[model samples]
Target: MQIKDFMIDQSLKELTEHRTVVLPIACYETTINENIHGYIPLHWHDELQFVLVRKGEASFQINEDKITVREGEGLFINSGCLHMAKDKNNNSGCVYICLNVSPSFVLSQELYTTFVNPYIQATNISYLHLVSKEFWANNILDSIMKVNQLIIENQPYFEIDISIHLTLIWKNLIMNGVQLEHEQKEMLKNKRMKQMLNWLHTHYAEKILLDDIARAGGLSRSECCRYFKRILKKTPLNYLTDYRIQKSLLLLQQPESNVTDVAYQVGFNSTSYFIDKFRKSMNMTPLVYKKYKNSHSPFVNNST
Candidate 1:
C-alpha cells in the first residue's frame, strides 16, 4: 500500500484502510518509503494486526519499547496499542504484508472469555515479536502468510478459510504464550497519555499551556512532563510544536495560503517563530516546501 495520508481521529485512532463492516478484515502489502512520510506515524486502531516482513527490515515503536522485525519475521500487535514503523537507516525501505482483523470478527463470547481476551486485554503485552526460530511463533507467522494468500487468491469460501486460520493462530498464542504480571500503573499511565493526546489533537489550533495539558490527563504539571518524556521520548511543549508544524503542512500546500496566515492558524504566536521551527523541522522554508510539493517535484523530505 502506497499510503499518502492516514485518516486519524482526535483520540489517535486510525480510520483509514479499514475494509467493510461485514467481514472487518483486510490484507495489504505495505512499503515504508519516502512517499508516506518515510514512516507510519503513531496511531491506534480497534483491530488486531499481523505484519509479515518480506524484505529488508522495519523498526517498530510500540508505546515505550522498540522492536525490529527483519525479513522472514513477523509481529502481532494487540488492538489499540499506539505504534509506528519506519526504516531506521532511511536508505532502503521495508516491504511487508499486513493483516488487520477486528477481534469481534473472530472471537465469539466463549472464545473471548476462554482464550483470546486474556492476552489481548493484558496491559503488559502490547505486542508479540515472532521469529522463525521459535516453533509456535513460526506457526503463527505461517498462518499469517496463509491468510494473506487466501485474501490474494480470493477463492470460494476464502473468508471461511481465513477465519479458521486466524482462530488457530489465536489458539497457538493462548497455548504457548508466556505468563506476564499485570502492570496496573502502566495501564493507568497509558490511559492518561491517551487523554492528553486527545486534548492536544482537539485543541492544537488554540493556544495551549502545560498546566492545561496536565489537567486534561489528570496529572500534576511535573508528572505530566515526566510521563510525556518517558513514553513519547519528548517534552510536552516539543510535541505540541511538532504537531503544529505537521498540521501546517497541509495548509501551506494550498495555493492561496501564505506563510504568515498558516503560522497563526496552527497556533504559532509569531510568523518568524513559526518559520524558524518549520525550517528546523523540515530543513526548508515553508514556501520552498510548498513549491516543491505543488510542482510534484521528486525532492523528498523524509523528516519524521
Candidate 2:
C-alpha cells in the first residue's frame, strides 16, 4: 500500500518518524499480530530495517518474496523498500527486535562510495535473510547482536560501539558481493518504478487506468504491469485495489464516516464490492475495522 497520507508518506513509509538525528539509529521491541489483526499492514521506511525474531515465527513481504523467518533468525530490508512484517498464523504474538540504521551515521565516504552508495543507487536485493551457518549471514547476525547489546547497555561510548557494529554488518554484506547489482539499467528501472508508484498513489482515489499509469511512468502498458509484477509480484489493478483498502483504513478513523462513504471517497464505485474486497484484505467489515482502530486509539502498533 502506497497512500502516503497523514501518518505515512506516499511510499507508505514513516521515514524519520521514529529515528533520531544525532544517533540516527533506533532499537524497537514489539509484539505484533496479537489481539487484533493477523499481519502488520504493508509499509516501508527510509532506513535499513533489521528484524530479529526473538519468539514465535514471523513472515515478511519484501518486494516479491514472502520470507518466513523463524525464531533466532533475522532479515535485512533495504532502504525505501516496500515490505510488511507479521506473525505467520496470527495465533501467537510475534515478538521481535528491530534495529533501524541510517548508513550515513556509520559509513565513511570511502565505504559509501564503494559499498553503500552502489547498494542504494540500484534496486535488486529487496532483503537478505540472515541464516545460521551461512558465512555472510552469520557475520551480519553477530554484528546485529553487538549493536543490540551496545544500544541496550548504553555504557560509555556506546554510540561508538553501535556505529562499529553497524559498519561491520555492512562490511560483511559488501564482502559477500551484495552490492553487485548497481548497474545503469537497474538504476533507470528503479527511478521509473518510483515515479510510477508516485503517480498511482496520487491518483488512487480517482478513476484511473493502467494506460494512464504507464504514461506517467514513460513505459508501455504491458511493460508497466511487467515492472510491478517483477518487483512486487502483483498486477497493477491488484496493487491499486489493495492501496484503496489501505486508504479506506485511514478514512474509517473518522467517526462521522460510514462504510459506503468511505468506500466512495477511496474510489470504489460499488459499496458491496468494496465491502467484499475490504473484508478479504482485512478479515473484517469496514465498520468493524473502524471500531477496532478506535479501541487501539493513540498507540500505533510498532510491530513493523
Model 1 misplaced regions, further than 4 Å = 20-22, 297-304
Please report, as a residue range, the 10-residue window in candidate 1 with the lowest summed lDDT. 295-304
Number of the top TM-score candidate? 1
Q: Estimate each model's TM-score.
A: 0.91, 0.83
lDDT of 2 by residue, 1-304 (tens): 0111224566566634445335878776767754233456566677888877878988888766788998888898888777777788776567777788776765987667766766755667778888867888788777777777776676888877777788888878767675355667866776687778888888899998999889988999999999989877788889899889978876898767899999999999999999999999987889889987777766655365
lDDT (0-100) at residue 15 of candidate 1? Answer: 86
List runs of model 2 lying over 4 Å from the truth: 1-6, 34-38, 122-124, 177-179, 295-304
Error of 1 at 297 (Å): 8.1
Q: Candidate 1: give the clashing pairs.
A: none
